[model samples]
Target chain A: AQTVTQSQPEMSVQEAETVTLSCTYDTSESDYYLFWYKQPPSRQMILVIRQEAYKQQNATENRFSVNFQKAAKSFSLKISDSQLGDAAMYFCAYGSGAGSYQLTFGKGTKLSVIP
Target chain B: SQTIHQWPATLVQPVGSPLSLECTVEGTSNPNLYWYRQAAGRGLQLLFYSVGIGQISSEVPQNLSASRPQDRQFILSSKKLLLSDSGFYLCAWSSQPNQPQHFGDGTRLSIL
Candidate 1:
């Protein structure tokens, strides 16, 4: 079974600053996908960024980026120029492959952006 | 663009009552649909998933059941609701198994 782990229960960052959320996973498959999802007070699950196991350049989406280290099974999310809107419960998720429909998610990390 | 819809934004039902939450997708065909439950301050718990019409897969053993009567419609149901079933029910869809899933606003179900 594939499992994702987010160690940071809570994180705080000042507006215009940067913050990083830690995430790790246990997967035997080499070809898989990793994702970072944000759930605000509205409770809407929004996709922040994604990374493919076969890609080594990492993935960046505007102010959000991922440091994906496949060998170490670590996929951390970095939020730059953090804004108040970035405050939310961030989750790390793992998917097996192109044919697997199961998405295993981590417990989650609550991010608080101080204005 | 594809969109997912889950309705009755908020629902309050009595214990032992029947439950039927509807979810539908538009602008996409043969998409993978999923049902998830989110408890307070907790992560998402995948309840069920479907690959196609009439193909439903259960991820957890619970009182809830799911059905895929149409390629774009998925339903979650329970013959008798339990208090523990009270949570935020979310419906999601993805173009493929490894793609990013788009989530619906969700249905806040409260069992009294």
Candidate 2:
């Protein structure tokens, strides 16, 4: 079974600063996908970024980026120029390439942007 | 564009009462559907996933069950609700395995 771990329970960043949320996963499959999702107070689960295992390049979406180290099984999310809207619960997820649509999610890290 | 809808937006039920939550996707066919629950500040816990009609997979044994009667519709049901069942229920859909899933606003289920 695949499991995702988020070490940080809560993180705080100043407005316009940068913050990183760490994530690690345990999986035996060689091919898979990783994702970062955001949920605000509205409780809407939003896709922040995604990274394919086969890709060596990291994934970046606007102010959000991921440092994906496949060998280390670590996928960390970085938020630059953080705004108040960035405050939410961030979750790291893992999915296998073998037609397993289910995503194993980390415990989640609550991000707070201090204005 | 594809969109997923889950209703009702919020639900409150008494303990031992029957519960039903519905999820439907639009502009897609044969897509994979999933049900997840989030407890307060915790991460999503996958409850069930369906690959096709009448094909359902359970990830945890609890007071809940899921069914897929239509290609793009998924339903979560429980004969008797429990206090542990209170959480934000999310419905998501993906075109294929390993693809990014789009989620609905989710249903806030409160079991009293």
lDDT for each residue of candidate 2 in B40-101, tens digit (9 for 90 to 100): 86888889999999999999999899999999999999999999999999999998888998
lDDT of 2 by residue, A72-99 (tens): 9999999999999999999899999897
The alpha-carbon RMSD values of the candidates against the true structure, listed in the order shown, are 0.9, 1.1
Candidate 1 chain B: worst 10 consecutive residues by lDDT?
Answer: B37-46
Which segments of candidate 2 are over 4 A away from where they belong?
Answer: none
Pairs that collide, model 2: none
Error of 2 at A70 (Å): 1.5
Write model 1 residue lDDT over B25-104, tens digit each, in one string. Answer: 99999999999999987889999999999999999998999999999999999999999999999999999889999999
What DockQ does each listed candidate score?
0.86, 0.87
True-vs-predicted CA distance for residue B112, candidate 2, Å: 1.3
Worst 10 residues of 2 chain A by lDDT: A96-105
Q: What's the lDDT for candidate 1?
A: 0.94
